[model samples]
Target: MTHEEKKKEESHGRPEIPAWMRAVAEVISAPGYERWARQVAATGGCSAPVRLVGESQVIDAGTGEVLHIYRTADEPTGHLLVACGNRRGAVCPACSHIYQRDVFHLIRSGLSGGKGVPEAVREHPRVFATLTAPSFGAVHTQRERNGKTLVCRPRRGGGVCGHGVPERCGARHDGADIRVGQPICPDCYDYAGAVLWQAHAGRLWHRFTLELRRQLARRAGMSRRRFDALVRVSFAKVAEYQRRGLVHFHAVIRLDGPGGHDDPPPGWATAQLLADAVPEAAGLVQVLSPDPGNGQRVLAWGDQIDVRAIVVRGDGGGLSDEAVAGYIAKYASKGAESSGTIDRRLSCGRCKGVGTVTMARGPAVCKRCGGVGTAGGLDLDRLPVTEHARRMIRTCWDLGGRPELEELRLRPWAHMLGFRGHFATKSRRYSVTLSTLRQDRAEHKTAESRQRNGLPGPESTEVLAHWRFAGQGYTEAQEILAGHISQRAITARRIEEQRREGA
Candidate 1:
């Protein structure tokens, strides 16, 4: 074949463009999308902008007559804009980047005082704390520091369990060990308990927060209700999955004066006092099950709970306002998929289909162990539960419940088990709200657009725009264009930042 023919064949045989890329390209090539196209290309086409292929009706205010019908083709239907809520990294990295940035700003605003928060908040006693789950069981781990290797899990005598499986792992695991999530002995791990723990983690956190507030009130010799009038506690927390596949939390807790942002705290509010209250409250707090499936289960914060004062500037300083904000923002964009679970729901039919594919013809060998007749079983040894997968399953099951448990329902996070708390949660008084920050960003964007378009500003008549979700994603051709746009935007942004710094 000629070189041209070969190239043509290769192009024809090219893998179908990824759905995400296709979606992005479609938006980039859409009407009035020059700006959005530039954005997508700058992000390396990692984001497929959502499109709104609909019509908007503009009315005459005085005559009450329809002035215009703005169709998708006429307006910017396929504009390459950031998908507002695509959380998965695989689907939309550009959108995720924007989200992460927003989270950082929201968090930082509270910490350092912007977006309406008082600047003096920087002086407030704050802490970047992590609350861990209690030990469910030991699993293989890798620990290395300064060229020293740590034994994976040293147990006496390299013993055997009741199931005759090795009781310990002697291999020195490296950071990339595939066996990291697998249990040394599946039977020894409390899989059921771990699932249940995930289901109730949100409740456990709520209880802990309440207990902390109560403790603070008692310490200050005031009623819990009265304490709210004097001092307020503000906190922002993010849930993180540990190597063990369990969910833990990192939080920034701050004490503020009553009346929220405008008021100053009483003289009694101190970082030491808040630090003392956290541990005492964490230790004292417990969530009890009046009716667990098998028996009553009492859940408490792990003994490893850490609380440290977040100094603005000092040795052993806690996380900076910006650092904490950035950290929380990064995690907020993640989902159970990060932990290794399926991103979308598996239909019963699909689940059965997967089972049939693996098990119907004959007993297939297990993926983990080359054991026959174990492919479709729930046995951890055969189909070892990945932390991500386990969390996904648990998240799904917990989301399905009777009316009694409806209050605990986390629908949007049904894929994350019953833990429907915000990816980053802040107490009311701690700092600026996510909504406020977002509004500020929107306003800034609007102002910038006006400036770029050379449109009249504050004195001009009210301008209006309407939008609807046309669709999400892009075509292969468009994705390429988007990639270019994204790269250019990023480069431009960096250049702009550098110039500002130089100036």
Candidate 2:
């Protein structure tokens, strides 16, 4: 149909769908729309479902009979649709929701024991640990004591010192304040320290874990090797961005038998021992590196290291397992989506080397080909970022030039403030993995499809298919329909969450 005709028809009785969406809307308005809709709906409305061209046939292993056959050519889109699977909600909400559910199950399984984890793991000691970035300078914080909002950075007689910035602001800052994480005096803030510290945060966690094992062994008056043979430590952690743009870790740490979670921990091993070792490990653990400008510096964790026991069922002891699992899972899908933290690297370094710099002139040099390693873009310079973050990025860029710090690759990751680590990680024996869970779910889905269609299961035959990466993303019309589907899926997920909470 013509664009104008479709518009007129939409106006006559049906709700007006966008011109780009008319093609998909017409399909929905066509006969046998439910089956077509369900095909797209199966992906939960992925914004960019992969388009695959393939065919498959289920053959009976014994009789060599073709029980079922399917091909992408017969699909509504003329290709198969699969979730893009971007964990970042900002990038793809539908995929992120799916990821979150998987992480939730993974974490919950480890905490309370399920999905291949033994129930004995529940009896083993575990702690919810939070590792934070050290203070660069005083920033606006919401502090409350006994339900009373205290003055932020209260200074006597409106005292103003070095840098001429306000020494105190008595106004109890709320969440909406734009200056919350901004350093009180950007000049005084250790921007370089913050950036370098971020680069080492992951290593710092590594050191902490290593030291923890040593500490536990020392407490037991045994050698490290002997400790390793006696008990095992397992943990699952995810990085979360603070308002200040630095990354902190939220981890669920558990103790297990040498055999793994399925086995009980040694009698001497306890949750309290793990908790006690955490503070000492954090205090002693330090990443030693030559400062970008100075000689040597010791990077340690923030003072506010939190280690709380995770109570599986009732909250008579500490926080519940459900809350801890849900909290970690919430951030798992976030994938470092936050303000002032650039999600990707800047294009400037694509230049051959740092020897020569291409300066951007009148019109912005599109970072495509002509502008490779170009300089003088005020795009980031003009943004209203906190001076703390601004300097951190600048430090990353400056440090990138130093040969001594070449391994850090500060310039390439200046956008991330010099952090180059996975957003989510777990040690072996933490629980079932995302890949395993997805595989199980897919197998179950295949079984369900076979039963629904009264077709023999894959067990009865050898199924083979040829597939190729046709493309990714949807046409404009498909995107609109996908958006509709994704939104419904999100709503359904929320309803499920609410129901679980209510139950």
Candidate 3:
């Protein structure tokens, strides 16, 4: 059998106890198994947990008397496990689900106004806008109308391109078709332009926001300075990867008074005005690509810009506030990995770049792949990605080596197809920050723990903590146990949500 086939068979082929199964049995019967299981359960079964060795002390601030003490050495295991807060679902589903829920609350608060924001902000002018990348080449796209799929890129003559590739395709591609995002003519595709556009997408978005303010000012027949002083622009946006391996921004743009959400915007600042300014600003904004070999190229937003008015209720035929918030939150946990890219970075195959590999018996220094991450590494040529994404990755690698394009750092972000921007971002005045949300949750948990333990409040005590990173992730045996816990947690959460909705 081939290597892939053998690996697949080993996972599900027979009922015999394999080496991994034997390891699982040993782990389950180990002395510290109960403690390990409790730690894993507390982390919500994080796929990749961060391991830490630490000691903490809580002392009375006024008297300097020791109040409480904790150490990893006291636990059954030598380390403490913390969830790796990765937002990408492909990397860690449990953590991603938490991140998604947090994002939803963040966005919803900015709309309906909660979590330290004023309720009056919900009455302010706001819009849901989609800014798309300019097309570099004709790609296979799925289109539907009136409950029926339409032929993709149909043409009367069905002519051929300069590369002797067909210019038109009549097939009706379904959403799951492999050719849904591939180029009709690979040779004729503008790979360089596409990569450059992707690299500069963040800058393009920044420029568009600036131009939007300018457009709003001009529409109001006021100077830019006066407009800035009178009104503030707040937004929360998430980047979603299109099927063609490019990112498009979906944003909730709002107008507020100069003092922020607490103050009312000018009377003229209506949702209709914001909607009118969006398309004009997107059409006007442009960014210049790095002049690497090819002369400077101008990149701008695509023609298919969508701007919709956000309303309090969807019953009146406008996009609802909750709908817009939920839509942006849903895409927050996604990345280029959704487009068939690997979730983790390529590294040493044997040791996985940690300089050591866990053996059947115990951990051992890897001699086969050495300590360097590149030894026995993945072959980029054999990556199981789409042809379009492969070309984009190759282009990023090639351009990354040039001295002129060094600032883009394309090599490290090849998995993202040259897109190096954050998946979710927001203006300072938009709402509560992700860090703030996380901090609040942490404080709440700490308070609950202190109450349960009959410990003093943080205001009357001082805490000192010392921690060192140990390692991350789980062994084969722990992974199986954690996976079951994670599924159970998800099912429980779903049931709770259904119950709440029904009530």
- Would you list the clashing residue pairs of candidate 3? none
In terms of lDDT, the poorest run of 10 residues in model 2 is: 369-378
- C-alpha TM-scores of all predictions: 0.76, 0.84, 0.90
RMSD of every prediction: 8.2, 5.5, 7.7
Q: C-alpha displacement of 2 in model 3, angstroms? A: 42
- Across residues 1-503, which tens digit of lDDT does each residue of candidate 1 receive? 99999888889957887877767766656666775555455333455666665455545555555544545555343343444456556556656666666667667766788777778887777887888888777777787778998878778878887778887787898877767756677777765566556667887888888999999999988899999888888888878766666688888888888776566678888888899899888898777643335556677778998887776754455666666777777777776655555455332322321222266787553444233212233342222346535544544444343334344433333445435555667676766666776677678776886677555453433444676665666566665665667666656765775697499
In candidate 3 the C-alpha lDDT for residue 266 amounts to 93
How many clashes in each structure? 26, 2, 0
Compare the candidates by TM-score and give the number of the best one. 3
**Which 10 successive residues of model 3 have the least lDDT summed?**
371-380
For residue 373, give model 3's deviation from the true position in Å.
Answer: 10
lDDT tens per residue, model 3, 1-503: 89999888778856767888898888889898888887887786589899999999989999999888889998877999999999988889889988998898889889999899988889999999999988888999999999999999999987999999989999999998989878999898888888888899999999998999999999999999999999999999999999888999999999999988788899999999999999999999988877677678888889999999899888976889889988999999998977766565554556544456888999887886565433465566678898888888778777876778878877667778889898899999999888989999899989997898789899999999999999999888888887887678667776886798599
> What are the lDDT figures for the candidates, one per model?
0.65, 0.80, 0.86
Q: In model 3, what lDDT does residue 127 have?
A: 93
lDDT, candidate 2, at 98: 83
If the candidates were sorted by their TM-score against the true structure, best first, what order would they fall in? 3, 2, 1
Evaluation by lDDT, superior candidate among 1 and 3: 3
